[model samples]
Target: MIYKYFKECKKLIVLITLLGMLIGMLFFITKDTPPTLVLKKKKINIEYGQTYYANFKGLVDTTGMSKKEICYLKKNVSITDNLQNEDQKSYPAVGKYKIFIKYNNKLSTIQIICKDTLAPVLAFPKNVDVIKESDLESIDFKSLIIATDLSPLKEIQIDTSQIDIHRIGEYQVKVFVEDIYKNRREKEFKVNVTENKQETTNSQNNQENNVNKIESENNKPNEDITISQSNEKNNVKDHLDNGHQQTKPPQMVYWYECYLCGLYVDSNVSLEDAKKKFDQTKCTDAIEFSGIEWRHSRFHYGINHS
Candidate 1:
């Protein structure tokens, strides 16, 4: 009986020892710690041409390791900070980049985004002149605009709705442009529409008519020179030799000037009929005035010019 009791006691002692070892293993695991690093900022932003430095102010856990242990861990860790490439150092292009930080078998990330906030430089013309009937395609719009932007230019828009190319007047042309980042710029310029050749000719004719009217009043003949129709026919041949004859015989037509445009209109029909004919055809700009002067050419019937 004593022998059997001693065997049972031995088994009980072995069970207590195994239980104590299991508890000790659990305590050792609980006391173990992990290396850690905490960062104050994980993301940063900067301008395209601004300077950047790779720096981190954070807490690093060295709970159960010495400086040598940490140094060894750092050697195994890989750090890649490609914020500034070779090209970026010279000319920084706007973009986003990531910094990879790996230490103590742990991974952390940093984000950097570059932006362009400055306004673009502009070189624009102050004024431009174009004829009223000028063609739009003939204008070199691109050459007139000189602009530079940090961000790429997306598009340029021109607004010419207020300018009438068919009318003689001053108008405004607005130019607008935008960058890739939605940065916008605008400029305005004056556009002058000048008269065409036909209009210039009309102005010159008006001046001549004014001069002729003043001369006719100043030089009144002392007596009217009478010549018979048969005698006039005989002198017609003589007038032709003196370059005082009409190359094409004059037709019996009403000759007058448009009061609105001051352009002379001559027709074989009556004054009213001439106005209607000009209205039906685009003989000149749409007439705004109806007053007409009944006049005849001074060169008619071989009247020599002084």
Candidate 2:
């Protein structure tokens, strides 16, 4: 009986010791200690050139083992954190990057992908001209513009209703090609508009001057003699043989400045009753007028000039 009692006591003592060891192991691992680290990102979906936040959700530490290193392999980044807090993520390139968050010996890793699959496009030329009076009623002018972005460009509108320019201006517009990824590239200056007619106010002024000049010439030279068609041929031939070019030839007088055509040099005779002084001669060979300018020339007929 005594021996059996002793054996039972020994077994009981051994069992107690084993249970104590198991309990002690538990205390060593779970007691007064930071658990493990759990790092989380605020969003899984993000765009290129976009921002995302990372947060440390759970962590436990007793011996300052909570200090962790964060790293991204693709972007050559390294960061250190002391608590379960926020994290920053950036997609600077086009590819997948592995993200790592490690607490001393414990670690968690994820993949981040950056992508670009879009092309940039031209936007607009809205109002070509600002106001009507600023430009000639017959002249063409400049336009205003706008630009925008949609997944792809659907339409671009240009207002040309006011343009009277015969020539069209060339303008470039951007067009985009897009994919599921929001990444973008640019193809600049792809559309154009050009004005068809070259406009010049100076030219129109010359025409007006020519008309006024012709009328004034009719009034001033009324005192001069008109050559009879019958005698004019011989007289002209005779004059030419004498090496005398007609003084009143349209070439010699700027038509745009003409104000004395049929008038005699005496300046006293009336044009309706005028008689010839240079009947066998020619009119003034050269003209000098005040503040005068010439416009243009045209082909001459045997008797009249255009």
Candidate 3:
């Protein structure tokens, strides 16, 4: 009975040993099979300051692996950028980087390209109103242009071929610019050209008529003041029934013109005083004119019978 019990125990021990050997052989054969890591793409591009999600879909079968092994493989994967100054989290510069992943003593490299994503903003000034054929000699586009960008501007191009200063109408002016990252922007504006000569002449004539009307009301036959619209000097003769010759003091007429203002003034007062009076009476708005013209004429007063 003791021999029978020992035989049974021996058979049980042999069976257990055979099972352990078979398991060991199976594990060794499976280990010889290489691990697989498949990716959707070998390279990827992302804009600067963009977020990346680690949704790696192609992880090999972790079925028979322990949780510790899977965690170790995932943790070994890292992404690094080639930019010099910025941190790894925020890729501030444009360059190429590598995404390296290590699993099962294998290294997989993926290309990651960083690029600029922001577009440039362009702004234009208020509409430009200029005289026809007068101030067209210079066009300062820099003053009217307002541009901003995250990167340096590559170029600014202006197209003014449609603007014809000689024509009395509104035209379009187009502008375009680009940034370092190939981002583009464009703007269009209007340039108005109108006839100002007719307006100025009519305004001058009206002012002259007003001055003449005022002088006519104040002047009398014996002591009259006459103003002529002639380019040359005129002599005023004073006649007396007594035939006695008496010379009257010379009368001074001063002319004032401001290019910005269409009003003209002629008076016998000093230049400073004349300007002050003109500013008070006509230039109530006190708007500044760009240019000025002044002239003075000396003549004697004439008596008119009419």
Candidate 4:
């Protein structure tokens, strides 16, 4: 019986040794292996104020990755940048940046460029009246233009080829501006070369003299009193015989002023019709008329009657 027990113990030892070897082989075969990471793009450009995501699928290639490995990488990937904030989706300012991405002990780098694509905004009057013979070269074109941009301006150019300072006419002036990021914008306005100062003053004085002469004539008293009194008596007798007095027709006049050219116009049409006529008769694209005023006068001093 003792000999039989010894043989059984030896068999038990051999079985236990085989079982341990099988367990060790299974553990070695099932161990996890590191994945190979490949960067698809090394440089990325994002517009100003654009949102950035932490997704690496577009920037990285993971062809043979299983669903579980992908999920693991998504949860464990890290991104670091100089301008990036933990709670922000984009950079705070416009400039060049470097982004570092790390996943599963593999490190990669990429360039993130924040670019400004919006053009500058320019604000100025649509019409500018410059006197004839004025020194156009002495004018500061930059000071007259109000430009707003997200970045510093590279250059501001004024195209005055269409303008003739020596002549009295309307001309177009264009302004072209560009930012540091190569964003460009252009705007145009009218430059009216008005009459010389001396000529304008002489014309105004002559107009004033004519107006004074008309006023004097209206205020003058009748010269032949006896004839005037006889005609007045006859007119009263005729009116009494007719049993009714004749009434003069009502006259309606509308007055409008051109804000751009500083010219006044008198019209016999309604106010709305007068405005429409004035707009239709505008010679320049920048000429704008003010609101019309109703008047009963047949003659205006500085107004062009129509």
* Cα-based TM-score, every candidate: 0.41, 0.29, 0.48, 0.47
C-alpha lDDT of all candidate models, in order: 0.54, 0.33, 0.53, 0.58
Between prediction 2 and prediction 4, the one with superior lDDT is: 4
Residue clash pairs of candidate 1: none
Candidate 4 lDDT by residue in tens digits, 252-299: 455546544444556665443444444444333241212223221111
Deviation of model 2 at 95, angstroms: 5.2
Per-residue alpha-carbon lDDT of candidate 3 for residues 176-196, written as tens digits (9 for 90 to 100): 888888888878877666444
How well is each residue in 1-306 modelled by candidate 2, as lDDT tens digits? Answer: 999999999999999999999999999887545444434442143334332233332111124343232221212222332222113321244455555566545555555554444343333222121111223322221121222222334333333343333434433333333334443433323121222111233355457668776444433212112122233221221122333222232211111111223322221222111112222223243222222222111111111121
Which one is best on TM-score? Answer: 3
Poorest stretch of ten by lDDT in candidate 4: 297-306
Give the number of the best model, judged by lDDT. 4
| 161-198 per-residue lDDT for model 1 (tens digits) | 88788888878888888887777888887766654444
Q: After superposition, how far is residue 232 of candidate 4 from its true place, in Å?
A: 57
Summed backbone clashes in each candidate are 0, 36, 0, 0
Runs off by more than 4 Å, candidate 2: 30-45, 57-98, 105-109, 116-145, 149-306
lDDT of 3: 0.53
How many steric clashes does model 3 contain?
0
Runs of candidate 4 with Cα error greater than 4 angstroms are 1-40, 48-53, 56-66, 84-95, 116-119, 138-141, 181-186, 196-306
